[model samples]
Target chain A: MDLVNVISYSLFAIGSFFLVVAAIGIVRLPDFYTRMHAAGKSDTLGQSLILLGLIIHEGASFISIKIFFIILFIFIANPTATHAVAKAAFLSELAPWKKDGGKER
Target chain B: MFLQVALVIVFSSIIALYRAISGPTIYDRVLAVNVIGTKTVLVLVLVEFIYERPEFLDIALVYAIINFIGTIAFLKYIEKGGLT
Candidate 1:
């Protein structure tokens, strides 16, 4: 295949892997805080990578520039949104998962 | 490859939707919804290329701004205890 196809396919594969990884983390992580660690980081990166692949395929179009903008927006917004959720959880005094050792902090 | 990426995004959407619907807390649901919104932004941009419609980028931009506003408003409401 040509380089465009190769790059696009690779990005697509990587993005899919990251997305699945985030999903697994969300399901298997012990608590909300830990789950955020998984979903926030993994999902954001996954979306960006996938967008990169597709934008490259689009190749020098105005739509491609807009795609990049969408990526930028997500890069800014996803983590901020996650932080807000986590902060809200903390400020509202939502309890974390109890440790197996029964220690409270 | 383009189609594959779209499929992956859709798969992630399913996962996020699960979180949104099955959350034990309101924040978790909101987080999931936010994730879905970000994914939608990417999806919209991709759709522009897929459909050969550059105008769709305008729609994506609008969606991005609206989604950000919606998430922030939700957070503000929660912070003020108005949502609870």
Candidate 2:
């Protein structure tokens, strides 16, 4: 109805779109490495956007501060966790998927 | 409005759940679980707004921390083939 509500709703829609993209990516990507790219980047962005919308809706308040902390945690931890998983998989000798269907390198 | 958004997120989590359940490798399942965890956080926030209960954000914050820790622990186990 008002400007704030409009902005919050639009942001919520955009965040949801990114979240769905990440989910589809995890399901459709050909390999673990590619899936990590999808999950790590899109999920972080989606969650941050949604949190931002909630913060805007709430305005200045303790809850907004808490939401901000959650955003910070997600920004820091999501990629770190993704990297850890990828590193473990690499260490375990998992091969990346090739476009030409070549043998594991 | 927020309810619709929450429903969309729930649907996405179900899709991620499929990957978690049927992934070809353990890493894929780990990644899907991570995605699902993040989505759950967003869903929690949405539910908080829908119910006018700001306190649930505390639970969402805690869940985010736990999700990150769990992912790292899973990776460590995979790398060492055990959790020692």
Report how far off residue A9 is in candidate 2 (Å): 1.0
TM-score of 1: 0.89
Measured by DockQ, the strongest candidate is 2
CA displacement after TM-score superposition, residue B42 of candidate 2 (Å): 1.3
CA lDDT, candidate 1, residue A91: 94
Q: Across residues A1-105, which tens digit of lDDT does each residue of candidate 1 receive?
A: 799988987888898798878877776666788789876899889888988888777789776787788889888878887888899889999889877836322
* Residue pairs whose backbone atoms clash in candidate 2: none
lDDT: worst 10-residue window of model 1 chain B = B1-10
How does chain A of candidate 1 score by TM-score against the true chain A?
0.91
The reply for model 2, stretches above 4 Å from the true place, is A102-105
Give fnat for candidates 1, 2 and onward, in order: 0.60, 0.97
Residue range A6-46, candidate 2, lDDT tens digits: 99889988998998998888888878888887888998898
**Residue B53 displacement (Å), model 2:** 2.0
Candidate 1 residue pairs in clash (backbone atoms < 3 Å): none
